[model samples]
Target chain A: MQLRFLRVIFICLMSVAGMVSAAADLEINTPAITALKNSMQQRHNQLAPYYVSGAVGLTRDGQIVLRDANAVPLPQRQAVNALVGAENQDRSALYREIARANQHPEWESEIRSTFAGRWIEKAQPGWWVQDSQGGWKKK
Target chain B: MTKKSCIALAALLLAACVTINIYFPAAAAEKAADKIIDEVWQLKDGEAAGGKGDTGSTDDRPATKPGATK
Candidate 1:
Protein backbone atom coordinates (compact mmCIF):
# COMPACT_ATOMS: atom_id res chain seq x y z
CA MET A 1 0.00 0.00 0.00
CA GLN A 2 2.80 2.42 0.87
CA LEU A 3 4.61 1.67 -2.36
CA ARG A 4 1.45 2.29 -4.36
CA PHE A 5 0.96 5.59 -2.58
CA LEU A 6 4.53 6.66 -3.41
CA ARG A 7 4.03 5.76 -7.05
CA VAL A 8 0.89 7.84 -7.19
CA ILE A 9 2.74 10.73 -5.62
CA PHE A 10 5.53 10.46 -8.12
CA ILE A 11 3.13 10.44 -11.05
CA CYS A 12 1.31 13.47 -9.68
CA LEU A 13 4.57 15.33 -9.21
CA MET A 14 5.66 14.58 -12.74
CA SER A 15 2.34 15.71 -14.16
CA VAL A 16 2.66 18.99 -12.32
CA ALA A 17 6.16 19.47 -13.67
CA GLY A 18 4.98 18.67 -17.16
CA MET A 19 2.25 21.25 -16.95
CA VAL A 20 4.77 23.83 -15.74
CA SER A 21 7.23 22.96 -18.46
CA ALA A 22 4.55 23.19 -21.11
CA ALA A 23 3.38 26.60 -19.96
CA ALA A 24 6.70 28.30 -19.36
CA ASP A 25 9.96 29.14 -21.14
CA LEU A 26 12.87 26.74 -21.55
CA GLU A 27 14.98 27.67 -18.57
CA ILE A 28 16.15 24.21 -17.49
CA ASN A 29 19.42 25.42 -15.87
CA THR A 30 20.69 21.88 -15.44
CA PRO A 31 24.47 21.70 -15.26
CA ALA A 32 24.59 20.15 -18.71
CA ILE A 33 22.30 22.78 -20.17
CA THR A 34 24.23 25.58 -18.50
CA ALA A 35 27.51 24.20 -19.69
CA LEU A 36 26.18 23.95 -23.22
CA LYS A 37 24.88 27.51 -23.11
CA ASN A 38 28.14 28.83 -21.74
CA SER A 39 30.08 26.92 -24.30
CA MET A 40 27.93 28.32 -27.09
CA GLN A 41 28.17 31.75 -25.54
CA GLN A 42 31.96 31.55 -25.56
CA ARG A 43 32.07 30.16 -29.09
CA HIS A 44 29.79 32.96 -30.22
CA ASN A 45 32.75 35.25 -29.65
CA GLN A 46 34.90 33.40 -32.13
CA LEU A 47 32.02 33.23 -34.58
CA ALA A 48 31.04 36.87 -34.18
CA PRO A 49 33.63 38.20 -36.58
CA TYR A 50 32.57 35.75 -39.23
CA TYR A 51 28.94 36.73 -38.78
CA VAL A 52 29.86 40.40 -39.19
CA SER A 53 31.80 39.66 -42.32
CA GLY A 54 28.93 37.61 -43.78
CA ALA A 55 30.95 34.41 -43.92
CA VAL A 56 28.69 32.29 -41.73
CA GLY A 57 24.93 32.40 -41.43
CA LEU A 58 22.38 31.02 -38.99
CA THR A 59 20.16 28.33 -40.47
CA ARG A 60 16.45 27.73 -40.03
CA ASP A 61 17.25 24.45 -38.27
CA GLY A 62 19.18 25.96 -35.36
CA GLN A 63 22.60 25.40 -36.84
CA ILE A 64 25.19 27.58 -38.53
CA VAL A 65 26.45 27.17 -42.07
CA LEU A 66 29.16 28.62 -44.22
CA ARG A 67 27.33 31.34 -46.13
CA ASP A 68 30.33 32.64 -48.05
CA ALA A 69 33.21 30.19 -48.01
CA ASN A 70 35.28 32.59 -50.08
CA ALA A 71 34.74 35.33 -47.48
CA VAL A 72 37.47 33.78 -45.37
CA PRO A 73 40.90 33.57 -46.92
CA LEU A 74 41.92 30.14 -48.20
CA PRO A 75 44.36 29.66 -45.34
CA GLN A 76 41.82 30.55 -42.63
CA ARG A 77 38.87 28.76 -44.29
CA GLN A 78 39.68 25.48 -42.59
CA ALA A 79 39.75 27.08 -39.15
CA VAL A 80 36.39 28.75 -39.77
CA ASN A 81 34.94 25.49 -40.95
CA ALA A 82 36.17 23.81 -37.78
CA LEU A 83 34.59 26.52 -35.63
CA VAL A 84 31.27 26.16 -37.45
CA GLY A 85 31.37 22.41 -36.93
CA ALA A 86 32.05 22.76 -33.23
CA GLU A 87 29.30 25.37 -32.82
CA ASN A 88 26.79 23.16 -34.56
CA GLN A 89 27.68 20.17 -32.38
CA ASP A 90 27.18 22.23 -29.24
CA ARG A 91 23.90 23.64 -30.59
CA SER A 92 22.58 20.15 -31.23
CA ALA A 93 23.53 19.15 -27.71
CA LEU A 94 21.84 22.23 -26.24
CA TYR A 95 18.53 21.47 -27.96
CA ARG A 96 18.66 17.85 -26.85
CA GLU A 97 19.54 18.87 -23.33
CA ILE A 98 16.61 21.27 -23.09
CA ALA A 99 14.18 18.63 -24.25
CA ARG A 100 15.62 16.02 -21.89
CA ALA A 101 15.60 18.42 -19.01
CA ASN A 102 11.88 18.95 -19.49
CA GLN A 103 11.34 15.17 -19.40
CA HIS A 104 9.91 15.26 -22.88
CA PRO A 105 12.62 14.00 -25.16
CA GLU A 106 10.29 14.22 -28.12
CA TRP A 107 10.06 17.96 -27.73
CA GLU A 108 13.59 18.33 -29.09
CA SER A 109 12.42 19.03 -32.63
CA GLU A 110 9.91 21.62 -31.58
CA ILE A 111 12.48 23.18 -29.28
CA ARG A 112 14.98 23.29 -32.10
CA SER A 113 12.45 24.79 -34.43
CA THR A 114 11.59 27.36 -31.82
CA PHE A 115 15.27 28.16 -31.36
CA ALA A 116 15.80 28.40 -35.09
CA GLY A 117 13.15 31.05 -35.44
CA ARG A 118 14.31 32.79 -32.31
CA TRP A 119 17.91 32.87 -33.46
CA ILE A 120 16.94 34.53 -36.68
CA GLU A 121 14.50 36.84 -34.98
CA LYS A 122 17.22 37.92 -32.57
CA ALA A 123 19.97 38.17 -35.15
CA GLN A 124 21.88 41.38 -35.71
CA PRO A 125 21.11 43.60 -38.67
CA GLY A 126 24.10 42.61 -40.78
CA TRP A 127 23.96 38.97 -39.81
CA TRP A 128 22.65 36.46 -42.33
CA VAL A 129 19.67 34.31 -41.28
CA GLN A 130 17.88 31.55 -43.07
CA ASP A 131 14.14 31.80 -43.51
CA SER A 132 11.66 29.01 -43.04
CA GLN A 133 11.75 28.47 -46.79
CA GLY A 134 15.55 27.94 -46.72
CA GLY A 135 16.29 31.37 -48.16
CA TRP A 136 19.07 33.41 -46.64
CA LYS A 137 18.56 37.10 -45.95
CA LYS A 138 20.39 39.70 -44.00
CA LYS A 139 18.68 40.38 -40.71
CA MET B 1 -30.90 26.75 -16.56
CA THR B 2 -30.91 23.22 -15.26
CA LYS B 3 -27.69 21.80 -13.73
CA LYS B 4 -27.60 19.22 -16.49
CA SER B 5 -27.63 21.96 -19.15
CA CYS B 6 -24.97 23.94 -17.27
CA ILE B 7 -22.71 20.89 -17.15
CA ALA B 8 -23.18 20.35 -20.88
CA LEU B 9 -22.31 23.95 -21.57
CA ALA B 10 -19.13 23.65 -19.49
CA ALA B 11 -18.16 20.49 -21.29
CA LEU B 12 -18.53 22.17 -24.66
CA LEU B 13 -16.48 25.14 -23.52
CA LEU B 14 -13.70 22.92 -22.19
CA ALA B 15 -13.63 20.91 -25.40
CA ALA B 16 -13.21 24.07 -27.43
CA CYS B 17 -10.32 25.26 -25.26
CA VAL B 18 -8.62 21.89 -25.34
CA THR B 19 -8.84 21.70 -29.09
CA ILE B 20 -7.19 25.07 -29.43
CA ASN B 21 -4.36 23.93 -27.16
CA ILE B 22 -3.90 20.68 -29.07
CA TYR B 23 -3.47 22.47 -32.40
CA PHE B 24 0.37 22.24 -32.30
CA PRO B 25 0.89 25.43 -30.26
CA ALA B 26 3.15 27.22 -32.73
CA ALA B 27 2.41 30.61 -31.23
CA ALA B 28 3.24 29.44 -27.73
CA ALA B 29 6.54 27.96 -28.91
CA GLU B 30 7.53 31.19 -30.61
CA LYS B 31 6.71 33.19 -27.51
CA ALA B 32 8.78 30.84 -25.39
CA ALA B 33 11.63 31.08 -27.88
CA ASP B 34 11.64 34.84 -27.70
CA LYS B 35 11.91 34.74 -23.94
CA ILE B 36 14.78 32.27 -24.08
CA ILE B 37 16.63 34.40 -26.62
CA ASP B 38 16.22 37.45 -24.44
CA GLU B 39 17.81 35.64 -21.56
CA VAL B 40 20.53 33.92 -23.51
CA TRP B 41 21.64 36.78 -25.73
CA GLN B 42 21.25 39.44 -23.07
CA LEU B 43 21.08 42.00 -25.86
CA LYS B 44 22.43 45.15 -24.28
CA ASP B 45 23.48 48.66 -25.30
CA GLY B 46 22.14 48.50 -28.88
CA GLU B 47 22.15 44.94 -30.25
CA ALA B 48 24.32 41.85 -30.37
CA ALA B 49 26.65 41.97 -27.40
CA GLY B 50 26.49 45.24 -25.53
CA GLY B 51 26.52 47.57 -28.55
CA LYS B 52 30.14 48.56 -28.26
CA GLY B 53 31.43 45.20 -27.16
CA ASP B 54 31.07 42.47 -29.75
CA THR B 55 34.30 41.44 -28.10
CA GLY B 56 34.43 37.69 -27.72
CA SER B 57 35.45 35.64 -24.63
CA THR B 58 32.87 36.80 -22.10
CA ASP B 59 29.74 35.25 -20.62
CA ASP B 60 26.74 36.74 -22.43
CA ARG B 61 23.92 35.54 -20.22
CA PRO B 62 21.25 38.18 -20.02
CA ALA B 63 19.85 39.64 -16.84
CA THR B 64 16.14 38.80 -16.53
CA LYS B 65 13.36 37.41 -18.65
CA PRO B 66 9.72 38.28 -18.95
CA GLY B 67 6.89 35.80 -18.36
CA ALA B 68 5.99 33.24 -21.04
CA THR B 69 2.78 33.50 -23.01
CA LYS B 70 0.55 30.58 -23.88
Candidate 2:
Protein backbone atom coordinates (compact mmCIF):
# COMPACT_ATOMS: atom_id res chain seq x y z
CA MET A 1 0.00 0.00 0.00
CA GLN A 2 2.89 2.37 0.78
CA LEU A 3 4.47 1.38 -2.52
CA ARG A 4 1.27 2.34 -4.28
CA PHE A 5 1.33 5.73 -2.54
CA LEU A 6 5.02 6.19 -3.48
CA ARG A 7 4.22 5.36 -7.11
CA VAL A 8 1.41 7.91 -7.15
CA ILE A 9 3.68 10.58 -5.59
CA PHE A 10 6.42 9.90 -8.15
CA ILE A 11 4.01 10.14 -11.04
CA CYS A 12 2.59 13.40 -9.71
CA LEU A 13 6.07 14.87 -9.24
CA MET A 14 7.11 13.89 -12.78
CA SER A 15 3.97 15.36 -14.29
CA VAL A 16 4.50 18.61 -12.38
CA ALA A 17 8.12 18.72 -13.53
CA GLY A 18 7.11 18.24 -17.14
CA MET A 19 4.57 21.06 -16.94
CA VAL A 20 7.12 23.40 -15.33
CA SER A 21 9.64 22.68 -18.04
CA ALA A 22 7.14 23.32 -20.78
CA ALA A 23 6.03 26.57 -19.20
CA ALA A 24 9.64 27.73 -18.86
CA ASP A 25 10.31 26.92 -22.51
CA LEU A 26 7.35 29.03 -23.61
CA GLU A 27 8.15 31.97 -21.33
CA ILE A 28 7.92 35.42 -22.83
CA ASN A 29 8.55 38.60 -20.82
CA THR A 30 5.19 40.25 -21.32
CA PRO A 31 5.94 43.41 -19.36
CA ALA A 32 9.23 44.01 -21.10
CA ILE A 33 7.55 43.56 -24.47
CA THR A 34 4.76 45.93 -23.45
CA ALA A 35 7.23 48.57 -22.33
CA LEU A 36 9.06 48.26 -25.62
CA LYS A 37 5.78 48.60 -27.50
CA ASN A 38 4.87 51.74 -25.57
CA SER A 39 8.25 53.23 -26.30
CA MET A 40 7.77 52.52 -29.98
CA GLN A 41 4.37 54.18 -29.93
CA GLN A 42 5.76 57.29 -28.29
CA ARG A 43 8.58 57.47 -30.76
CA HIS A 44 6.18 57.04 -33.68
CA ASN A 45 3.95 59.84 -32.44
CA GLN A 46 6.93 62.12 -32.15
CA LEU A 47 8.41 61.24 -35.52
CA ALA A 48 5.26 60.99 -37.61
CA PRO A 49 4.20 63.93 -39.76
CA TYR A 50 0.97 65.78 -39.03
CA TYR A 51 -0.09 66.23 -42.65
CA VAL A 52 1.79 63.53 -44.50
CA SER A 53 1.16 59.80 -44.13
CA GLY A 54 3.94 57.46 -42.99
CA ALA A 55 4.79 54.40 -40.95
CA VAL A 56 7.60 53.64 -38.47
CA GLY A 57 8.89 50.27 -37.33
CA LEU A 58 11.31 49.11 -34.65
CA THR A 59 13.47 46.05 -34.10
CA ARG A 60 12.76 43.38 -31.50
CA ASP A 61 15.36 44.94 -29.23
CA GLY A 62 13.49 48.25 -28.99
CA GLN A 63 15.52 49.90 -31.69
CA ILE A 64 14.14 52.11 -34.47
CA VAL A 65 14.03 49.81 -37.45
CA LEU A 66 12.34 51.22 -40.50
CA ARG A 67 10.59 54.39 -41.72
CA ASP A 68 8.53 54.76 -44.89
CA ALA A 69 7.47 58.21 -46.15
CA ASN A 70 6.00 59.38 -49.43
CA ALA A 71 5.44 62.78 -51.03
CA VAL A 72 2.00 63.05 -52.62
CA PRO A 73 1.91 64.87 -55.90
CA LEU A 74 1.17 68.53 -55.23
CA PRO A 75 -0.39 71.03 -57.57
CA GLN A 76 1.37 74.00 -56.09
CA ARG A 77 5.06 74.41 -56.85
CA GLN A 78 5.85 75.77 -53.41
CA ALA A 79 4.03 72.91 -51.76
CA VAL A 80 5.89 70.40 -53.93
CA ASN A 81 9.29 71.90 -53.09
CA ALA A 82 8.38 72.09 -49.43
CA LEU A 83 7.28 68.48 -49.46
CA VAL A 84 10.58 67.41 -51.03
CA GLY A 85 12.59 69.29 -48.46
CA ALA A 86 10.52 67.91 -45.61
CA GLU A 87 10.98 64.37 -46.90
CA ASN A 88 14.76 64.64 -46.82
CA GLN A 89 14.81 66.31 -43.43
CA ASP A 90 12.37 63.87 -41.87
CA ARG A 91 14.32 60.88 -43.15
CA SER A 92 17.49 62.23 -41.58
CA ALA A 93 15.68 62.96 -38.33
CA LEU A 94 14.30 59.43 -38.24
CA TYR A 95 17.82 58.03 -38.40
CA ARG A 96 18.97 60.42 -35.72
CA GLU A 97 16.01 59.67 -33.46
CA ILE A 98 16.54 55.89 -33.65
CA ALA A 99 20.24 56.24 -32.97
CA ARG A 100 19.54 58.48 -30.03
CA ALA A 101 16.87 56.23 -28.52
CA ASN A 102 18.98 53.05 -28.67
CA GLN A 103 22.39 54.72 -28.36
CA HIS A 104 23.45 52.35 -31.14
CA PRO A 105 24.03 54.03 -34.46
CA GLU A 106 25.42 50.87 -36.05
CA TRP A 107 22.11 49.07 -35.60
CA GLU A 108 20.11 51.86 -37.27
CA SER A 109 20.02 50.43 -40.77
CA GLU A 110 19.56 46.86 -39.55
CA ILE A 111 16.76 47.85 -37.22
CA ARG A 112 15.15 49.97 -39.89
CA SER A 113 15.18 47.13 -42.39
CA THR A 114 13.78 44.70 -39.83
CA PHE A 115 10.92 47.01 -38.94
CA ALA A 116 10.34 47.97 -42.55
CA GLY A 117 10.09 44.35 -43.60
CA ARG A 118 7.65 43.61 -40.80
CA TRP A 119 5.52 46.66 -41.50
CA ILE A 120 5.33 45.74 -45.14
CA GLU A 121 4.43 42.18 -44.31
CA LYS A 122 1.66 43.24 -41.96
CA ALA A 123 0.29 46.18 -43.95
CA GLN A 124 -3.46 46.04 -44.62
CA PRO A 125 -5.06 45.92 -48.02
CA GLY A 126 -4.89 49.17 -50.08
CA TRP A 127 -1.93 50.30 -47.94
CA TRP A 128 1.38 50.90 -49.73
CA VAL A 129 4.87 49.85 -48.67
CA GLN A 130 8.29 49.16 -50.14
CA ASP A 131 9.91 45.79 -50.75
CA SER A 132 13.39 44.52 -49.91
CA GLN A 133 14.79 45.43 -53.31
CA GLY A 134 13.49 49.03 -52.99
CA GLY A 135 10.53 48.22 -55.18
CA TRP A 136 6.99 49.32 -54.41
CA LYS A 137 4.22 46.80 -53.63
CA LYS A 138 0.62 46.96 -52.53
CA LYS A 139 -0.40 45.31 -49.31
CA MET B 1 16.03 11.80 -21.99
CA THR B 2 18.95 13.71 -20.55
CA LYS B 3 18.54 17.43 -19.87
CA LYS B 4 21.12 18.20 -22.54
CA SER B 5 19.22 16.14 -25.09
CA CYS B 6 15.98 17.89 -24.18
CA ILE B 7 17.64 21.27 -24.67
CA ALA B 8 19.01 20.16 -28.02
CA LEU B 9 15.56 19.06 -29.12
CA ALA B 10 14.07 22.39 -28.08
CA ALA B 11 16.72 24.31 -30.02
CA LEU B 12 16.06 22.19 -33.09
CA LEU B 13 12.35 22.89 -32.84
CA LEU B 14 12.97 26.60 -32.54
CA ALA B 15 15.24 26.58 -35.55
CA ALA B 16 12.67 24.74 -37.60
CA CYS B 17 9.97 27.25 -36.64
CA VAL B 18 12.03 30.30 -37.68
CA THR B 19 10.58 32.09 -40.68
CA ILE B 20 11.46 35.43 -42.31
CA ASN B 21 9.88 37.11 -45.31
CA ILE B 22 9.17 40.62 -46.69
CA TYR B 23 5.63 41.82 -47.49
CA PHE B 24 4.53 45.31 -48.61
CA PRO B 25 2.03 46.63 -51.13
CA ALA B 26 3.59 48.39 -54.15
CA ALA B 27 0.74 50.86 -54.73
CA ALA B 28 -0.09 51.19 -51.06
CA ALA B 29 3.56 51.62 -50.17
CA GLU B 30 3.90 54.47 -52.64
CA LYS B 31 0.81 56.14 -51.27
CA ALA B 32 1.99 55.66 -47.70
CA ALA B 33 5.36 57.09 -48.51
CA ASP B 34 3.79 60.04 -50.21
CA LYS B 35 1.41 60.66 -47.33
CA ILE B 36 4.26 60.51 -44.81
CA ILE B 37 6.23 63.10 -46.71
CA ASP B 38 3.22 65.36 -46.99
CA GLU B 39 2.39 65.07 -43.31
CA VAL B 40 5.94 65.81 -42.28
CA TRP B 41 6.02 68.90 -44.43
CA GLN B 42 2.79 70.15 -42.90
CA LEU B 43 3.96 69.51 -39.38
CA LYS B 44 7.42 71.03 -39.79
CA ASP B 45 5.90 74.33 -40.90
CA GLY B 46 2.19 74.86 -40.65
CA GLU B 47 1.15 75.37 -44.25
CA ALA B 48 -1.09 73.67 -46.76
CA ALA B 49 0.60 72.65 -49.99
CA GLY B 50 -1.94 71.54 -52.51
CA GLY B 51 -0.93 68.58 -54.64
CA LYS B 52 -2.46 66.17 -57.06
CA GLY B 53 -4.46 63.81 -54.90
CA ASP B 54 -3.33 60.14 -54.94
CA THR B 55 -6.83 59.06 -55.99
CA GLY B 56 -6.48 59.68 -59.72
CA SER B 57 -3.35 58.54 -61.54
CA THR B 58 -4.21 59.98 -64.91
CA ASP B 59 -0.62 60.82 -65.90
CA ASP B 60 0.78 57.34 -65.17
CA ARG B 61 4.15 58.99 -64.60
CA PRO B 62 6.47 56.71 -62.70
CA ALA B 63 7.98 57.70 -59.34
CA THR B 64 11.47 59.20 -59.54
CA LYS B 65 13.01 57.40 -56.57
CA PRO B 66 14.61 54.00 -57.03
CA GLY B 67 12.70 52.82 -53.99
CA ALA B 68 9.47 53.76 -55.74
CA THR B 69 10.25 51.39 -58.63
CA LYS B 70 7.06 49.44 -59.33
Candidate 3:
Protein backbone atom coordinates (compact mmCIF):
# COMPACT_ATOMS: atom_id res chain seq x y z
CA MET A 1 0.00 0.00 0.00
CA GLN A 2 2.84 2.40 0.80
CA LEU A 3 4.40 1.64 -2.59
CA ARG A 4 1.12 2.45 -4.31
CA PHE A 5 0.94 5.74 -2.40
CA LEU A 6 4.45 6.58 -3.45
CA ARG A 7 3.56 5.85 -7.08
CA VAL A 8 0.64 8.26 -6.89
CA ILE A 9 2.87 11.01 -5.51
CA PHE A 10 5.44 10.35 -8.22
CA ILE A 11 2.82 10.56 -10.95
CA CYS A 12 1.47 13.81 -9.51
CA LEU A 13 4.90 15.41 -9.58
CA MET A 14 5.53 14.35 -13.15
CA SER A 15 2.21 15.73 -14.35
CA VAL A 16 2.82 19.04 -12.60
CA ALA A 17 6.18 19.35 -14.26
CA GLY A 18 4.70 18.59 -17.63
CA MET A 19 2.07 21.30 -17.22
CA VAL A 20 4.59 23.86 -16.05
CA SER A 21 6.97 23.28 -18.92
CA ALA A 22 4.30 23.38 -21.56
CA ALA A 23 3.05 26.68 -20.18
CA ALA A 24 6.53 27.87 -19.32
CA ASP A 25 6.77 30.51 -22.00
CA LEU A 26 4.31 32.01 -24.43
CA GLU A 27 6.57 35.01 -25.00
CA ILE A 28 8.75 32.90 -27.25
CA ASN A 29 9.50 34.63 -30.52
CA THR A 30 11.28 33.71 -33.73
CA PRO A 31 12.31 35.29 -37.02
CA ALA A 32 9.03 34.28 -38.59
CA ILE A 33 7.04 36.09 -35.91
CA THR A 34 9.07 39.24 -36.38
CA ALA A 35 8.42 39.14 -40.12
CA LEU A 36 4.72 38.73 -39.56
CA LYS A 37 4.74 41.67 -37.13
CA ASN A 38 6.52 43.84 -39.67
CA SER A 39 4.01 43.01 -42.36
CA MET A 40 1.08 43.65 -40.05
CA GLN A 41 2.59 46.90 -38.82
CA GLN A 42 2.99 48.18 -42.36
CA ARG A 43 -0.55 47.18 -43.19
CA HIS A 44 -1.99 48.81 -40.08
CA ASN A 45 -1.32 52.19 -41.60
CA GLN A 46 -3.71 51.34 -44.40
CA LEU A 47 -6.30 49.68 -42.18
CA ALA A 48 -6.48 52.30 -39.41
CA PRO A 49 -8.75 54.71 -41.27
CA TYR A 50 -11.29 52.04 -41.99
CA TYR A 51 -11.23 51.00 -38.36
CA VAL A 52 -12.08 54.54 -37.30
CA SER A 53 -14.75 54.89 -39.97
CA GLY A 54 -16.48 51.68 -38.91
CA ALA A 55 -15.86 50.22 -42.32
CA VAL A 56 -13.67 47.60 -40.69
CA GLY A 57 -13.75 45.90 -37.31
CA LEU A 58 -11.71 43.55 -35.16
CA THR A 59 -13.47 40.19 -35.15
CA ARG A 60 -13.80 37.92 -32.15
CA ASP A 61 -11.70 35.34 -33.95
CA GLY A 62 -8.50 37.38 -34.23
CA GLN A 63 -9.26 38.76 -37.70
CA ILE A 64 -10.24 42.05 -39.20
CA VAL A 65 -13.29 42.14 -41.43
CA LEU A 66 -14.86 44.74 -43.68
CA ARG A 67 -17.85 45.35 -41.47
CA ASP A 68 -19.64 47.80 -43.74
CA ALA A 69 -18.58 48.39 -47.27
CA ASN A 70 -21.06 51.24 -47.59
CA ALA A 71 -19.05 53.16 -45.02
CA VAL A 72 -16.17 53.28 -47.46
CA PRO A 73 -16.32 55.44 -50.56
CA LEU A 74 -17.22 53.33 -53.60
CA PRO A 75 -13.86 53.87 -55.26
CA GLN A 76 -12.02 52.92 -52.05
CA ARG A 77 -14.15 49.84 -51.28
CA GLN A 78 -12.04 47.43 -53.28
CA ALA A 79 -8.88 48.71 -51.66
CA VAL A 80 -10.40 48.13 -48.24
CA ASN A 81 -11.23 44.57 -49.20
CA ALA A 82 -7.67 43.94 -50.24
CA LEU A 83 -6.33 45.42 -47.03
CA VAL A 84 -8.60 43.28 -44.88
CA GLY A 85 -7.58 40.16 -46.76
CA ALA A 86 -3.89 40.82 -46.36
CA GLU A 87 -4.26 41.74 -42.71
CA ASN A 88 -6.13 38.55 -41.91
CA GLN A 89 -3.61 36.43 -43.76
CA ASP A 90 -0.85 37.89 -41.64
CA ARG A 91 -2.90 37.61 -38.45
CA SER A 92 -3.51 33.90 -38.94
CA ALA A 93 0.09 33.37 -39.85
CA LEU A 94 1.19 35.19 -36.72
CA TYR A 95 -0.84 32.91 -34.50
CA ARG A 96 0.45 29.84 -36.26
CA GLU A 97 4.02 31.06 -36.08
CA ILE A 98 3.78 31.87 -32.38
CA ALA A 99 2.39 28.42 -31.65
CA ARG A 100 5.06 26.77 -33.77
CA ALA A 101 7.71 28.84 -32.06
CA ASN A 102 6.62 27.38 -28.75
CA GLN A 103 6.76 23.90 -30.30
CA HIS A 104 3.03 23.66 -29.77
CA PRO A 105 1.56 24.03 -33.21
CA GLU A 106 -1.58 22.41 -31.90
CA TRP A 107 -2.07 25.46 -29.71
CA GLU A 108 -2.68 27.67 -32.74
CA SER A 109 -6.39 28.08 -32.15
CA GLU A 110 -5.86 28.87 -28.49
CA ILE A 111 -3.34 31.50 -29.40
CA ARG A 112 -5.74 32.88 -31.99
CA SER A 113 -8.51 33.16 -29.45
CA THR A 114 -6.23 34.80 -26.94
CA PHE A 115 -5.16 37.34 -29.52
CA ALA A 116 -8.76 37.93 -30.50
CA GLY A 117 -9.42 39.20 -27.00
CA ARG A 118 -6.20 41.15 -26.82
CA TRP A 119 -6.86 43.02 -30.05
CA ILE A 120 -10.21 44.21 -28.86
CA GLU A 121 -8.89 44.98 -25.43
CA LYS A 122 -6.16 47.12 -26.88
CA ALA A 123 -8.37 48.79 -29.46
CA GLN A 124 -8.75 52.53 -29.39
CA PRO A 125 -11.94 54.17 -28.36
CA GLY A 126 -14.39 54.84 -31.21
CA TRP A 127 -13.02 51.89 -33.15
CA TRP A 128 -15.36 49.01 -33.87
CA VAL A 129 -14.70 45.67 -32.21
CA GLN A 130 -16.65 42.46 -32.13
CA ASP A 131 -18.01 41.06 -28.91
CA SER A 132 -18.03 37.45 -27.90
CA GLN A 133 -21.60 36.93 -29.11
CA GLY A 134 -20.68 38.06 -32.62
CA GLY A 135 -21.98 41.56 -32.23
CA TRP A 136 -20.01 44.64 -33.21
CA LYS A 137 -19.79 47.72 -30.99
CA LYS A 138 -17.61 50.76 -30.88
CA LYS A 139 -14.84 50.32 -28.37
CA MET B 1 3.27 -10.81 -11.50
CA THR B 2 6.07 -8.82 -9.92
CA LYS B 3 5.36 -5.65 -7.90
CA LYS B 4 8.12 -3.81 -9.80
CA SER B 5 6.46 -4.52 -13.17
CA CYS B 6 3.11 -3.19 -11.87
CA ILE B 7 4.70 0.09 -10.79
CA ALA B 8 6.37 0.47 -14.19
CA LEU B 9 3.06 0.04 -15.98
CA ALA B 10 1.42 2.62 -13.73
CA ALA B 11 4.23 5.07 -14.42
CA LEU B 12 3.79 4.68 -18.15
CA LEU B 13 0.06 5.31 -17.93
CA LEU B 14 0.60 8.44 -15.84
CA ALA B 15 3.17 9.73 -18.26
CA ALA B 16 0.80 9.20 -21.14
CA CYS B 17 -1.90 11.05 -19.26
CA VAL B 18 0.37 14.01 -18.78
CA THR B 19 1.20 14.13 -22.47
CA ILE B 20 -2.43 13.97 -23.43
CA ASN B 21 -3.64 16.63 -20.98
CA ILE B 22 -1.39 19.55 -21.84
CA TYR B 23 -3.31 22.81 -21.47
CA PHE B 24 -3.26 26.13 -23.27
CA PRO B 25 -1.71 28.88 -21.18
CA ALA B 26 -4.17 31.71 -21.65
CA ALA B 27 -2.46 34.33 -19.43
CA ALA B 28 0.90 33.82 -21.07
CA ALA B 29 -0.70 34.05 -24.47
CA GLU B 30 -2.32 37.36 -23.49
CA LYS B 31 1.06 38.79 -22.51
CA ALA B 32 2.58 37.55 -25.73
CA ALA B 33 -0.29 39.02 -27.68
CA ASP B 34 0.17 42.40 -26.01
CA LYS B 35 3.84 42.44 -26.84
CA ILE B 36 3.07 41.83 -30.48
CA ILE B 37 0.23 44.35 -30.54
CA ASP B 38 2.27 47.15 -28.97
CA GLU B 39 4.95 46.59 -31.56
CA VAL B 40 2.53 46.47 -34.46
CA TRP B 41 0.44 49.43 -33.36
CA GLN B 42 3.51 51.39 -32.53
CA LEU B 43 1.62 52.65 -29.49
CA LYS B 44 4.56 54.84 -28.52
CA ASP B 45 3.07 58.33 -28.58
CA GLY B 46 -0.53 58.36 -27.65
CA GLU B 47 -2.51 55.59 -29.45
CA ALA B 48 -2.00 57.20 -32.85
CA ALA B 49 1.23 55.94 -34.33
CA GLY B 50 1.09 52.38 -35.60
CA GLY B 51 4.31 50.70 -36.74
CA LYS B 52 7.81 49.80 -35.75
CA GLY B 53 10.85 52.13 -35.60
CA ASP B 54 9.10 54.50 -38.03
CA THR B 55 8.31 58.12 -37.21
CA GLY B 56 4.56 57.48 -37.50
CA SER B 57 1.84 56.79 -40.01
CA THR B 58 0.88 59.43 -42.56
CA ASP B 59 -2.57 59.89 -41.05
CA ASP B 60 -3.26 63.10 -39.10
CA ARG B 61 -3.30 61.65 -35.61
CA PRO B 62 -2.31 63.69 -32.58
CA ALA B 63 1.42 63.80 -31.90
CA THR B 64 1.22 62.92 -28.25
CA LYS B 65 3.12 59.76 -27.33
CA PRO B 66 1.53 57.12 -25.16
CA GLY B 67 1.79 57.65 -21.35
CA ALA B 68 2.84 61.26 -21.93
CA THR B 69 1.08 63.89 -19.80
CA LYS B 70 -0.43 66.95 -21.44
Candidate of highest DockQ: 3
A1-112 in candidate 2: lDDT tens per residue? 5555455555555655654443232121244432333343334344444222433332232222234433432344354344445444444445345434433456445544
lDDT of 3 by residue, B10-63 (tens): 677677666654667777888888888987887754443443566645446567
Clash pairs of candidate 1?
Answer: none
TM-score between model 2 and native? 0.30
Best by lDDT: 3
Candidate 3 has which clashing residue pairs, if any? B45-B65, B45-B66, B46-B65, B46-B66
Please give the fraction of native interface contacts (Cα pairs under 8 Å between A and B) kept by each candidate: 0.21, 0.00, 0.52
Query: Which CAPRI level is candidate 2?
Result: incorrect
Distance from true location, Cα of A125 in model 3, Å:
0.3
Q: Where does model 1 exceed 4 Å of error?
A: A1-22, B1-32, B39-42, B45-70
Better of 2 and 3 by TM-score: 3
TM-score list, all predictions: 0.65, 0.30, 0.73
CAPRI verdict on model 3?
A: acceptable
TM-score, B chain alone, candidates in order: 0.38, 0.27, 0.40
